[model samples]
Structure formats: structure tokens, C-alpha cells
Target: MGNTPSRKGYEKQPEKTTLFKKEPTGITYRIPALLYLKDTQTYLAFAEKRSSPSDSDAKILVMRRGSLQNGSIQWSPSQEVTSAFLPEHRTMNPCPVFEKNTKTLFLFFICILSNTPEHRQIITGRNKARLCYVTSSDDGQTWSQAKDLTESVIGKNVRRWATFAVGPGHGIQLESGRLIIPAYAYYVPFKCFSFPIPFTVQPHALSIHSDDFGQTWRMGKMLQRKSCECEMAEIIDHEGRSHLYCNARNTHGHRVEALSESSGAYFDKPRLAPKLVESRHGCQGSVIGFPAPEFVPNDEADSIGGTTSPLSPDTQTWLLFSHPTNKTSRRDMGVYLNRSPLHSSGWDQPWVIHSGPSGYSDLAHSEDVEHFACLMECGKESELEQIAFVSFNLSDVMQTVDKREKKEL
Candidate 1:
């Protein structure tokens, strides 16, 4: 194991507020998705309310509205998203994306048959999940009725997929006004049809994009490498070029990283990130890009092996990733920094945030508040106990990095 710092040395830790607590009646919350509106200084946090901790027990989507007040977040009570559902189906994976031109928020998710597990679909080679979404214009106060897009968006192609799902986290809108939703599909080989005994299912990460607002959406080509639950971010390189970066979960020892030059229409061959090790079976992670900070003289930027400084002539995009730091278990939520996002090997060691059992998490970068916020699953004994929210600034991250360097020396 590397020389990771303990949580005792931090002078000030970010305050964590529980947004959704599990009930005694076995009602639990999981799969967090967060979005920050810079114009209104509002935060919309979303999750799946499940009857139990199992995936097939997911019932509905719940949300909370938080406003920045005096440098702290004031979260409102949780509210069920009544309009984002079908009659007899269970909702999972609340993926929210915002469009600046239409001033609309799109919450995309998958509606699976009640009591039907994903393994069944893979074995039968018949998909039982539907692509759906609901729209909101007033910052999630209300939503439009759920619209089924399975026929329109993925017509005739559903036969190739045994099952699929959208992001369990947030999506992104590009500078050219295109909306990109990270998704993955389980593909069954052609030979499985004739000989159905030994089923072969492969998961590949792809994107569902819309160019003209949210009117029409199309599917992108999947990555050649195997990947699962993933997130995408737009990164501006040192030369002012935009590249769509994908970070995905895999059963391999490390995480999968890929880049797309055409705004996620297609991705290049993926590589394993040696610095970002994965948990046992792999876990969902969140990634977000922000403008690089101004460079200062005598800084230790070279120690991280980054090629571009913060004060480059063109704007540079830096990345923040949240995931479990443990290699064998989903514990100790860690936030990692990448000063050079264009390179796959530029990630630094994570700064351990929550020191206990941790699960799925979503990240949102608020430029207005100058802080990064996260909604995660953490508890004393198990990660499914509660969904909490926390916020921290760049200074907090840098301090942890400096302390780790001193300890190593």
C-alpha cells in the first residue's frame, strides 16, 4: 500500500449534513445524483428510494433542494418525484442534465419491470428496461410526466442489447449546445442466439447525445474495451482544444479511461489508470472538470508530473474524481485531483474524505460558490445507511496533498 495520510492531521474538515436517512421500516436511499445551477445558486440532489438495499427493490426517485446560505448549504426536506415514473415499473439511476438555451433540466433514468433483476435479462437475451426522462423548467419544483423514449431514441437497436442503463450520476452539456448522457449496454454475441446455453454478455460504455436541445437524441458507438457505470466530462487542453473524457468501472484491477474528440460520438481505445485502483468488483465513480487555478511562482506542480501549469496562455481543465480509495472494499471515500486532464497518468493520490464505509457518490462543481459538493452513501457499519452532502474548496484538497508529501519525505 502507498503512504496515504490519516484523517487525524486535518485542521478543519468539511461539515457533512445528512440529506436522506434510512428508515427503521427498511426504506433506504442509494445512487446519488447532484446538479448545481450557477445562475440561481441552487443545488438539486437526487437519489433512488428503495424498499431494501437491493437493486430490484428500488421504488421511486427522491430529491432535495439546497441553497447556499452564509457559506453553508441549507437543504430542504426530501420530496418524492411523483411525475418521474411509469405505472407498474421501478425507477433507477437518476441522471440529471441541464440545457442553458432552453432553461430546462432533464432527469433521465431507466424503468425496469418490477421484481425483475438484471441477471435475468442477460440470461434470456431479452431487454426489459426502457429509456425514460422527465423535464423541469422551474429548477425541479415540478416535472413533466415521464416520457418513454425507447421506441424513438433506440428503435430497432434494442435487439442487440440484453439490458442497458443511463448514468447513476449527472450528465453534461457541451459548449456547442450538445447534451451528453453517459450510458452502458450489455451486448450479447450473435452466437448466443443459436446456442443459448452458455450465455455471453459484455458491457460497453457509450453516450446518448442530443444536438438540437433535447428534441432528438441518438446513441453513440460503444468503447471497444469492456466498461460499466461511467461518467463523462469536457476537458479543455493546453492548446484550447476540447476533449470528452470518460471514466468507467471495470472488473480489472484499475479503472478504465478513454477520450473522445468528437464530443462523445465515438471513443478511442481505453487504457487502465494505474493510479486509480478499483474495488473488488468495481464501483461507480464521479468525475468533474473545472478551470485551472492561477499559477504561482515556486509551486510544486512538477512533483505531480503535469506538463501544463495553471497560468498557461490558453484555458486548461483540471479534473476532480470521487470514489472508494480501498482496493478490496468500498470504504473510505477519497477525492483525487488531476492537474493535467489530457494525460491518463496525471492523477494524484486521493485525499481521504469520509473514513468509513462509503458507496456510490455524485460530484457537482459550483463556480459561483468556489467549492465542490458531493452526495454520497456512507454509514457506520454499512454504506447504505444514509445519503449525506458535503462541500470543500481547492485549498482543502491542496493542504492534504502537501501534508502527504511531507510525510513521505
Candidate 2:
């Protein structure tokens, strides 16, 4: 498919982009551009609600598809469907999932603490966060009113910042027709909120099984771990075991994805895998069933948590998507794509799908990456994710730092 003609590459170079536009970076950037699929075609997109390195209040844009066999897409008008209704000081995580059983689309997100300069310098104690939800019946053309899922079950002593804690990054319906939702939670950062005693924070990947589709739910086991680590997505194994994955970042800057086996009921603590992504704090990535090619250089690690991704019916391979940041002050970040063989023992390959104005990336799938017939969000993030232009510049800073690291090393 890449056989198209290359115009006189030796004779010319591409135009230089404006510096102000900046490159993708880990710092000042936050994007979990979600991915979703419609027809056989794929589409990629992100929200304008977040305060990523890009601009504030950006629009949600879809990819342009191919005209021939790969038809292109026109940009849809941006929607203000993020956490704009929440207090301006709060940030959130936006995750989308497609439940095949009910044919329903669920958008799960959580509003969290502000890392703004003022908050960081002046505030003390654990910061409180709230979790919310919204739904789209028509492939995201429009969303149902945003609803608060936190008040329903969650009270206090909980940090919504934990991956999937607000809701599952992705969920699976069991053979018994029970809906299994992936979820996580942890103690707020020691001084994150206003409290006298720091809570015993335990990050985890747990689930909520629903017999009536999301109308009612039951709690699953707490994926046991002494450290904070939880952001779970599902993949049905060849042996019929369900594997739950997420990042476990200890005091070290590096992060490893841990896996747990669940049989619709019980779960084991995450067993560590060699998948090493230099997640400074931690990054969310996603996995689907695309059988991506491979990562030649860094060696694709495991564990990804992004907006939304799914496994193909055959489940031979999985497409994993994410936004990349460096171990240093992340900036000049970009979107990356990767793949892993199902039931195999090796980390999958990775590809760079797209780059952001800043570097907060969430990945989803619809049809294509180059030309989106369907992508949820990768271009930018919603304020629900974080709306700080102040920190947005961190992506630029990360670029400078990474260059220096390579030079020194």
C-alpha cells in the first residue's frame, strides 16, 4: 500500500514548522486521544476540552481518510462535551469503551486535582477528585448529558486519578452475559488533598460486574498490590483466561505493566512483566486487535491505557496505542502505535501514529491511522484531562532534555 510515488526526495526538503506551534513533549502535555472503529475502516481523534500542550479549548478532529480504497474524513465541529461543567481547578481522565453486548458506547472519566503552579506551591494535603460518565448512542455524533457516577457509589478517601478507577479503560461482557467493568483507585497523593492524616494509598485494578448492563453492579476483587498501580483493560486469552493489565510505577521513574488472570469472578495480584515504558509518573496506553507490525528500536513493552481500543473477533493480534513522553521533563511528545501477538510471550512492535501540538495522547481505533475513518481523540485532550497552558509548555522542555540525555549517554 506504500507503493505510491515519492516526489524527488533527494532534491528538496519539507518546510519548517513554526516554533511556537512546538513539538510533542511529555511535560505540559496530557492526551489519551481515544480510538474507536465503525465500519471496517479505522478513525483516530481527540478532544479539545483538555489543557494539553496544544491550545486550550481545542476542537475534536477526526483523521482524513484515503480517497481511493481508503476514503478520507472531513473535520467535525468541536464539541464542549468534557469536564467544562466542573470546577476550573480540577482535571480529569477521559476514557471511552464499546460494549459489544448491549451495543452501547460508554464514556468514563474522572475529575482530579490541579497541578497548577499555585496549587503545587500553596496547597497541601490530599486533593479530592470526582468521577463522571457520558454516553453516545450514535458513534459519538452526539453524547447524552454528562452524569456523575462518583456520587452514586464513591464517597470520600478515594483518588479518581487512578487509571480506570473512575471506570474501566475498556470492559468485557462475559459468556454468562454479565458485564465486567475494569476499575482502579488509590489514596490521594500524601499532600494532594486537604486532610490531617495521609490516607494509605493503594493503587489497584478492580472490576464491577453488572447483570443488568450498567443499571446495577457488584464489586470484584481488589487486584492486590502494596504499591499504587492500576489501570486495567481486558484481552481474552487463547486458554480462555481474561488478562487485566495496567502500569505499576514504584519510587523508580520507570514503570512496568503487570497482569492478572480473572475468570469473571476472582483475580490475582499483578505479576510483573518486562514491558518497560519510561513513564515518569505513569502513562496510560491501550491495546486492540490489529496485529501491529513491530517496534525496531525501543522494543515494544506491554501495558497500554488509552481512550478506547478493542480486540478483533479472531483475536490473533492486538493494536496498542499511546502518546509518548521521555523519562525527563516530557515534551515534544508524539503519538505512537504498536502491536502484539495474542498468547505470545514477546512484547509487540510499536509505530508512531501521530504527533500532538503538546504530548498528551489517548488512542482509540475506527479504521485507519494515516487517514482516520474513525479515531476518538489524539490531536488534543479535553479540559477534563487538564487545561493548563502553563504546563502545556512542558512538552517543549522535554524535547530539550531528551536531546541532552542522548548526548550525555
Candidate 3:
């Protein structure tokens, strides 16, 4: 750990390194999703290999593995996971969730027809997306054939939607054996659908969930009003009940946050998270609920999400959110923390990672103690050049805690 000054005092910063950058080849990498497999102590970085920075040019999904050893991370060679797409379709967005009991990983994404752009979808009220996924049994070393779930999972729900997308980042599995994939759909009122609305249709964040593992998945009711490009986390509220917390991008003034009782299915109306800002034109962000370092016990279960620690302000599940810090531009990737999950005001000022030209980041809590990783889009001149993986520690983002409160046992 490296020492850096914080609001409280000197704090430790995790070693940061760049995992991948675009070579001389014109092919660019963007939209990163990260998953940390505790059992294998491996980190999987997934992204889209685009012919250019444009969204419609995505050709294939690519990934690389990073092994944690000693105090540093060793990354493997990049490899193509699959290119299963029709000649006129492109695969994009990679969201992965792991089931501890079954030891299976599910990868979710959407395929968009080449000729149909998002603008056309909203104007015509027709979505040209196919929801699909693949499963891997041995970590990410192997994967099952791609399965198109458009008819089964998104068939009727998308009929009224102008456009929809699965997470471009990681998803979460709750303590009660539920898998939730963060998603969003653009809705146009019937009047707006018939003719071009004054403005582009805003989106609402929703989830595609599975109760009996990943055997069958269902779409959750959309969260209230304009929210998009979301991520979900299982947080233990003050009442000792497990609640699903959602944080999403918004075209409105600020980021949107909401809570759900039945896992990630139904949500309360959303409100702006004042401390979290959405870069102009909106930007995709990532969120996760993690065991507070001071409260985590040595004998905790190995499952991803489960029972809460003894109910207390100090023992509650904490949240970490990542996005760009700039109010008008996508730059200076920042990670914000909220010790109190039930309230939006608990979010602290961010600890910045990339200080320039950064956007669309995903956060993953390290199974290894006191560490976390961020997979982000950044470049020397712009945010779309390449995808990079950065690592940080708890102390880095816990800057506001007083000396005594931030101290580790």
C-alpha cells in the first residue's frame, strides 16, 4: 500500500496499473466489466473490441484474466471469448454474475442489428435488440454456447419500449439465491411514439432477475421516472433487512437512486443522489455493497451476498459508486463511498483515479482484504481510446473518516 494524504490524515493507496491499451491497430476497446472470483483469486476484465469508438461498430467481446499474487496483480494475455452474431448484428455490453453454491458464471449482453440505430428506435418506438447470455463452469476458462433469451426474457416487456440494454458492467447475486442483472429501457408515450417528441425519450432503470439460480429469468418492473445504465447491490439496512439498492445514470440534473424490497424486482420511486453527478449527456456508473472492513468477521460465509452483520450504524453494509467527476465532461474518474446505505446523503466526496479523459467505469470489491478494482475507459487525449484496469484499497476511498474511525484493526 502507498501512502497518500486524505481529509483525515495520511491514507494508503493501492498499487495502480494499466492492464491493456490500444496498440497501433485501429481497433479500439471500450465498455469494461470486471468480476473478481474469490475461489480462484482471479479477476476477469471484459470489454468490446470495436473497429472504432462508435457504438454500432462493435465486432466481438474480449476478455483477460488477472491473478492476484503477493501484493500485486498479474494479467494474462487477451483472448476473444466469442463472436457469435449474425452478419448484420453486433454483440455489446458484457455483464457477469457468479453463483457461489453452484459455481457457475452467467454472462449477459445484447445484440443490436447493424442498420437500426438508437435514434431510429426511439423515433419509431421499435427496439432492435436481442437479449442473450452464455454460461461458464470453470471460472472464465470455458463458456457454453450463446443462448438468445429475447423471446423468453424480454419479449413482451420490450414491445412497448423504444430501446433497451443490459448492463455494460457487472451484476450481483443476492444472499437469498437471486441473480439480478442491471438494465434500462427507453419508454415513449403513445403520443410521442406516433410523432417525434420534442426531446429524446428518457430511460428507466430495471432488472432481469432469476429466483431459482439462473434457470429462468424475468424482467422486473421499471424504476420510477428517468434513470438509465444502472447497477444493483444488496445492502443490509438499519432494520437488519436485506434491501436491494440501485444507482443509475440520469439525463436530469443528478444521478438517480432507489430501493427495492423483493430483491431487485420492484423498486420504490427514485430520487436524485445529490452528491453523485451525471456528466452532461449522462454516463454509465457502477455500484456495489461491500462488507465494511472494520466490521467484517473472519468466519463470514463464502457466498457473495448474505445475512447482515449485527445491526448497527457501524456494522451496516457500505456502498461504493464509480463515475466521472466532471459536471460537464467525462473526465477524472471518481469513486464515492456511503457508509450509511439507507440514506443518500451519506455519500462522501470522491477519491479520483484517472485524472483526465475517463468515463464508463465498473467497480468490483476484491475478495482479498482491503482491495478493490475499477475497469474504466480512458485515454491520453480522450475517453474512448482503450480500456484500462485500476486497483485501489479501502483507505483510498475512505478519506473522510477521522483518524480513529479509519484505522484498521
lDDT of each: 0.88, 0.40, 0.81
lDDT of 3 by residue, 1-409 (tens): 1334433234443345565577577688889999999998999999888887778778888889999889668889999887445457898989999988799999888889984778788877778988888899999898888888889987776767888899879999987888999999987655443654646566888999998889999999999778889999999755578899999888776999999987877899789999898877989999988876544322233255543344246435889998988888898777888888788998877776666688888889876477888999876698886677777677556543333353543
Q: What is the lDDT of residue 240 in candidate 2?
A: 57
Model 2, global lDDT:
0.40
Each prediction's RMSD to truth: 4.2, 10.9, 5.8
TM-score result, candidate 1: 0.93
- In order of lDDT, best first, we have 1, 3, 2
Cα-based TM-score, every candidate: 0.93, 0.58, 0.88
- Candidate 3 overall lDDT versus native: 0.81
Model 2, span 89-108: residue lDDT tens: 34444455555566666666
Clashes of each: 0, 78, 1
Candidate with the greatest lDDT versus the true structure: 1
RMSD of 1: 4.2
lDDT head-to-head 1 vs 2, winner:
1
